[model samples]
Each structure stands twice: as structure tokens, then as C-alpha cells.
Target: METITFHSYRGGVGKTVLSVNTAVQLALLGKKVCLVDFDLRAPSHQSLFISSTFSMSPTAKSFTGFLVGDHEPQSVINSTDKENFYCVFSDIEIFQQKESKVRTKLTQHGEGRILAKLFEFVRYCNTQKFDFLIFDCMPGVTYRSLDALIVSDKIMVVTRPVKSEISGLRLVISECYSKLEGAEIFSIMNQVENIKDLVHPPNPLDVNFAKVNVLGITKCLEESSVPIPLLHSFPRVPFVTERIYVLDEKNHPFTVEIETFCNKLLQK
Candidate 1:
């Protein structure tokens, strides 16, 4: 089974959106896929799945619990309504308990043991004959995020077309991504400017500025210390809130973009 991790230098870049929809899309294609919410710092998959047209088996065994040896690997996996699609969610409550043993195990020490638990989960998935194991990781370079990166076969670096992200992305690449030896690194340039989506009469200045933003981000990736190949670019799709568009609105531009991205990812 191929393991892929969706990571970002910063939050609010739609990493979870891409990872969640991609997993569902793959399941729709008749693949046995499991998506793990490794973003324990601020877990959202539980809520996202709860709100979507999908249902996760009610379980108290969270990924964090499994990592801390409070639960077994098999127990943490919550089956979903979608066939061949399963998910392991992280418990934010556990993380929020500043003095909680689970939180201490994850944050203070036992780095090696925590990584082993992650590997154990992957092995369990492999034994279950899963086609893909995707991790919706927390943004930035934390020990947990790095463990996910180290265990992944491919790292999907999600970035946005913003000037502020340019320098931050560079630092992440230099300090974190560059040191990773085995995993193949690729980037997804998300929230890109698409003139076609502009208003009835687009302003000239707005159009020019959009072009510059896209160009700046492109150059940032190409010129980074370790150039990360651009896998796909997703146009900014305005949404009031997060939902699984692939299931709720299959024809949505965002869902269509996700489908196209999944197709390209399968090729790799």
C-alpha cells in the first residue's frame, strides 16, 4: 500500500479539504483506502466526517489513544458508510488536557515509541489489504508531523499563492523537507487565481495582481533549495464552510479539481 501525507508549512491552506476528498474519491473508484487524521494538534477529520454524507462507526478509540498505548491499532480504525473507506480520528480532548498522560506521551518524550506506533498502524493497514493510506497531517514541523513525513511514500506539500507563504515555504523545505531522504516530494499550488472565475467584468489591476501572485508562488517552488514538482494547481473555490464536495456536489469545481488531482496522484 502506498502511504501519502498531506502537509503544509502553515494552516488555512486547505490541506484537510484536499486529503479528505481525495480519500473519498479513491474509495469511489473501488480502492480500499484509509485516511488517518494525524493532525492531533487540532483534529478536524472527526467533525468533517460527521458533517459529510458519511458516517464513522461510533468509537472512543482515537489515534492519539492508540499512539499512547491506551488502545490497539485495530480499535482506533472507524469504518465509514462508504465501502472500502475507513478513517482513524485524533482526539483533541486528549490533547487539550495539558496534564493528560496521552498528551504527555505525544508531546514530551517517547518519540521513538510514538513513531513505532505509527508504523504499526501502517502495517496493520497493509495487512488489511488497503490500496492507499493517506495522512491529513498538522501544518508545520512538529515531531508528530515529521514522523508522518518519515513514514510516507509521498509527501504532498500544499501551499497557497500568497506572498507571506513564500519565505515560510522556503524555510520548511530547507529545515524539514530537505532532510527527508526516501520520500518523493511534490507540491500542490492551491487557491490559485483563475481569470475565468472572476466577476462579470474583471478589473485590470486585479487580473494583473492575480497573475503576479500565481507567478510568485510558482517561482518559489521552482527556485527553492530542493525544488518540489508541482503536481496540480487548484483554483480558488469560494465555500461558506467545509464539506465533502465530492459526495455532496460531485460536479462542484472543487470536487472536479480534486478528481483530477487524484487521477494524477494514482499515476505516481
Candidate 2:
């Protein structure tokens, strides 16, 4: 299994959106994919696939459930309408109920069982042998995020054109890359106005890191008032407010960017 972790330095850069949508795009291509939401701050991946899925219940068997021994590690995996795509989301109840405990597990570093449980969860994911295991990581430099970086075979630092976010991504590369031996690093520039403008010289953020692949740019999502439908056939691109881009429509212009991104991953 190829383990990919999606991360961002700051919040509100659409990290979870990119992670979930990428999983959907891969599933659309008929590949077996699993998305695990490690965004303990506010896990929301379950809402995206819960309605139409006939798989495991995020509320019944969540990451917290597994950690607290309420559920088995393998039993929490939930499937979606997309045949082979699956996800493991933290139960909102458990997360809120065990906030302090969860925080302790994630922040206590080496002197805790949370990290060990996390690796055990990683082992379960690897054991499944899914073609891809996408980790929807939380923002900032928490120990949990660092742990995700450690486990990832490849890391995609989701950044925007903003200076602070770019600098944060750079810091992540400078510090984390050395620790992650043999792991490929990617800078997936999100919320770009123009992909072409970025490719030319004097690129945004200057692109000096050799291991960091500028895996093209993904366009900003559009906001909408209409509730986006649960995707069955993807014919339209996604809207920022809804999972519409590649999940709702396949022929949308955004689909090309997703195709290119996933293809680049496959190539690596």
C-alpha cells in the first residue's frame, strides 16, 4: 500500500477537502482507496460519505473507539458509494467526549500509548493492502502531525500562495525531510488563480527543494447555496462548499488537474 499524508501548516487551506477529494478521484479510477481522518481537532470525513455508504459506522467504531478499546482497529473502516473506497473517521462523540484524553495521547509524545495506538492503526491500514491509504492530517505542528509525517511514504504539504503558509511548508520540508528517509515530498499548491503562471520562472515560493515536486496546482473551489448531492456519477466539477468538483462531475475542468496530480503520484 502506498501511504500518502496530506498536511498544511495552517488551517482553512482545504486540507481535508483535498484529501477526501483525492480519495474520491482515485476511487473513481477504480482503485481501492482508504481515507483515514487523523484530524482530531475536528474530524469531518465521515459526513462526506455517511449518507450513501453501507459500511462501518464512524459513530459506532471510530479512531477513539479503537484507541479506547471500544472497537477493533479493522472494524472501524467504513465504505462509500464508490465501490472500493473506504474511510476511518473519528467519532464526533468520542472525540468531544474524550478530548482531554485524546489530547494527552497525541501530545504526550514518546511517553504515551496514543502514539503506539496510532502506529497500530497504521499497521491495520497497511495490512488491508489498499492501493492507497490517504491520511487526512490535522493542521499545525502538533506531535500527532509529526507522527503522521513519520509514517507517510510520501508527504504532500498543502499550501496556498500566502507567504506565511508557504514559509510553513518550507519549514516542514527543512525539518521533517531528513527524518523521513526515502519519503517523497510534494508541494501541492492549492487555491491558485492560474496553474500556468506558477510553472514559469520566479515561481511562487521559488521551488528550490529538489525532493519537493510542484505537482501542479489545484484551483480554488466555488461556494454555493444549493446543497450538493451525494455523488453517484461524477459529471460536474466540485464546488468549494460541496464535494462537487471531481466527485460530482467527471468532465469538469478541475478533473484534469486531479488526474494530473494522481498520475504524478502513480509515477513516483
Clash count per candidate = 0, 10
lDDT of 2 by residue, 1-268 (tens): 8888888778877777677778878888888898888887788776766543334454436775676556778788876556887888775664455556654554557564666676787788778878888889888777778778877878776766554554565556555554567666665666654434444555545444211322211111111121111111112233555353676666766666677777666777
Local distance difference test, per candidate?
Answer: 0.88, 0.65
RMSD of 1: 1.6
Provide the lDDT at 124 for model 2.
82
Candidate 1 local accuracy as lDDT?
Answer: 0.88
Off by over 4 Å in 2: 51-60, 94-99, 110-112, 195-239
Residue-wise lDDT of candidate 1 within 1-268, one digit each (tens)? Answer: 9999999999999899899999999999999999999889899988888877786655758888889888888898888778888998988998888987668789754748888988999999999999999999999988888889989999999999888888889888987899998899999998887777666878888788777777887888888777589999998887725788888898898988989999999898
TM per prediction: 0.95, 0.75
lDDT score at residue 16, model 2, on the 0-100 scale = 76
